[model samples]
Target: MGRWMKPEVYPLFAAVGVAVGVCCMQLVRNISTNPEVRVNKENRIAGILENFDEGEKYAEHGLRKYVRGRRPEIMPSLNKFFSDPE
Candidate 1:
């Protein structure tokens, strides 16, 4: 194999990775600093008897019991990380 691909391929992949990382970091920072944004992820429109049809839906507790919405309750570390400041 004589130079399987252009030398630019590695750099392009690195650039894409950096871009994705930066975007993810910014998203995390935004979610952390804004409670309104976090609140938007909670459950508000569903009633107790409402039937869900195998799709994403929030419960009255703001998160679904069956593993949803980053599920901090299921992970102690995440729960601590997302704890409201005093």
Candidate 2:
């Protein structure tokens, strides 16, 4: 009754599904079975550590921001940005 895919192609679709499932299972095993990865996973801040540098990086950056001529570009038009007049 369907026009897009033939019934005979169902086996090919099932084979692709099984292949993808096997790849996913292997990926999970690779991550979960690693000693280093396991240690990282057990950490409380692992998720945050993935994207953020350790505190020392920020300490140096903050110390440098007070150099003589550096000005933070504080937003110029705060009222225009927040209020849309009707």
Candidate 3:
């Protein structure tokens, strides 16, 4: 009916708690830094190639159209962004 106050039992509880905390921290750290989380450019390109079709555009052009509104066009805005050679 009473809690265990034996001198030896306190250390056992403390040890178990520390071990569990360490294991949890390790799990969190590992999950955050997992190497398999990044996107693979080659795989993305291969997927697009697999679904290749005539008259279809590249992803960059598709993205430009989606953001800027209209059919996909392949003109780079870099010329406008950079200063003229004059």
lDDT per residue for candidate 2 within 1-86, as digits (tens), equals: 58648988899989999999999986785565433344453564554444334344534454475664654546636755776565
For model 2, state the Cα shift of residue 50 in Å. 23
C-alpha root-mean-square deviation, each candidate = 14.6, 14.5, 19.1
Candidates in order have lDDT scores of 0.55, 0.60, 0.57
Off by over 4 Å in 1: 1-6, 40-86
Q: Which candidate is the best by TM-score?
A: 2
lDDT of 1 by residue, 1-86 (tens): 44746786888878989999999976885565432343342433332323454223322333345456554465777667788554
C-alpha lDDT of residue 69 in model 2: 68
Clashes in model 1: which pairs?
none
Task: Pick the lDDT winner.
Answer: 2
lDDT of 3: 0.57
lDDT of 2: 0.60
Candidate 1 to truth, TM: 0.36
